[model samples]
Target: MPKLVRDRTLPALCPFCRAEILRPGEVEGGEWYDFAAGSCTCGAIFAHDPTARNGGAVFLQALLMVSGGDMDRAMELAEGVDYDVGYVQKYNVELHRLEPNSFGTLYFVRLRALGGD
Candidate 1:
C-alpha cells in the first residue's frame, strides 16, 4: 500500500474555529522565548513547535498569551473545564502541510469559560 501524501500548498486551519490561519509571527511579550504565534477569530491561540519536542513550552506560551500574561491563572486552568486543547501534528509551516514524516506540531488552546464569564 502506498503512503498517503497531502498537498503542501494549502492553508492550515484553526482547530477551534476552522478558520484559515495566517502564518504565525514572532509572539509579543516574550522576546526571550522564540515562538511563531497567532490567534484565531474564535479566540483560540496557537504556537508552532518546529521541533515537536517543545510542546510543553509551546503550550505554556499559548496559554500565557491567551490569558494575558497570567501565569498563575494559566497554570491553574483545567484542560476541559476552563479551556480546550488541540494539536496539528506533523505540521510543516513552510509548506503548510501535514507531512507524514515531519516532527513539527502546532498547539492550540481556547478558553471555554473563564472567571466571571
Candidate 2:
C-alpha cells in the first residue's frame, strides 16, 4: 500500500483560512473544516486566490510528477498542463529556467503515489 506522508512540521495556519486549523488526526474526518468556512480563532479570512504568474510550487510539483524524474518528461508535462505545445518545447530547450535542482527527486516521490515504485 502506498503511504501518504503528512509533513509533521506543517504550520497551524490553514491554507484556506490562514487560521490555526484543526489537524485531521485531532478530530474525526467528518468534522474537518470546510473550504468555504474560513472561520478560525486567528481571525483569518478565506480567499479563493489564484496562483501567481510563476505557477508556484504546486505547478512545479505537478511538472516533476509528469516528467518521471526525467528532464524531458518534466518539460513535456509542464507543456501539457499549460496547454501549449510550443511553450513546453521551448522550456525544455532552455532548462536553466526551472529552479531547485530537487525537482527530479520530487517527481520520483510523486510517481510513487501512482505505484510507479
Per TM-score, the best of the predicted structures is 1
Candidate whose lDDT is highest: 1
Q: Which parts of model 1 are misplaced by more than 4 Å?
A: 1-10, 114-117
Q: Residue 114 error for model 2, in Å?
A: 11
- Each candidate structure's TM-score, on Cα atoms with residue i matched to residue i, is 0.82, 0.21
Per-residue error (Å), model 2, residue 20: 24
Reference-based TM-score, model 1: 0.82
Q: Assess candidate 2 and give its lDDT.
A: 0.27
| Candidate 1 lDDT over residue span 1-117, tens digit each | 999985554457888777888777787666634789888878888899999789888988888887887888888988988889988888788877667777888899899853225
Count of steric clashes across candidates, in order: 0, 2
What clash pairs does model 1 have? none
**What's the lDDT of the predicted structure labeled candidate 1?**
0.81
